[model samples]
Target: MKACIYPGSFDPITKGHMDIIGRARNLFPKVFVGVLNNPAKRNLFSVDKRIEMIRRAAAGMDGVEVVAFDGLLVELMKKLDCRIIIRGLRTGTDLELEQQLSVINGKLLPGAETVALLSKPETYFISSSAVRELIEFRADISDYVPKEVADMINGGNAK
Candidate 1:
């Protein structure tokens, strides 16, 4: 079976992420939305919470599974038998970073493909950090995140 992986910190999944995931689901037979549990970066939500948020956002999405993994993404992709990695490009920086990582991952995995999708214009400006900021200020984030995610992040206030 052809399978692909979309890996991200997903501190809290945003609408932009859901857009890429929906598109990737259309392209790949099986798409695993891998939540990266990177130790180097402090996360707003725990891995379990991120996974739960993704699952809620992706409810009823067939052939798309939400999972969490720690360690090198390349190693996890290899173990998952995923030959493709889906990435969302929202800006020039995103493209640059993704290209660099693709080259590095290529050298490491040889045949793993990194497919970067352009975010839909409407959601392109949304990012998890911005969502967190909006929540901090008590701004309406209904347009930027799914209701489940919005609810999860809305409890905190600005310092």
Candidate 2:
């Protein structure tokens, strides 16, 4: 079965992320949502918590598996035996960075292909950082993230 890796920090797994995952699921038989565990960066949610949030957000998504990973994304792809990388693009700035990563990943893993899915206009401006800021201010995030995630964040579960 063909599979693709959709890798991200996914601190809280926003709706935009889910949207991309759904889109990727439509193309690939198996979609592996690789949650990056970057210790260098301080995350609001623990890796395990993030995984749980993703699982709840993607509860009924067939063939969608949430897994925590560290190190290079290509390494995770090799481990998953997947050659395709699924990314969500919201703007030109995101495109520039994602394109660069795609080039580097292609060089690292020969035959690797990165597929960029443009975010829907409604969700184009929603980002993890933005959500974090909203949380800091105790602002509403129901529209940006799934209900489960919003509850987790508002329930004082974040670090």
- Clashes per prediction? 0, 0
- In order, candidate lDDTs are 0.86, 0.92
Which segments of candidate 1 are over 4 A away from where they belong?
154-159
TM-score of each: 0.93, 0.97
Clashing pairs in 1: none
Relative to the unseen true structure, what is the C-alpha lDDT of residue 27 in candidate 2, on a scale of 0 to 100?
A: 97
**lDDT (0-100) at residue 135 of candidate 1?**
66
Query: lDDT tens string, model 2, 127-150?
Result: 999998888899999999999899
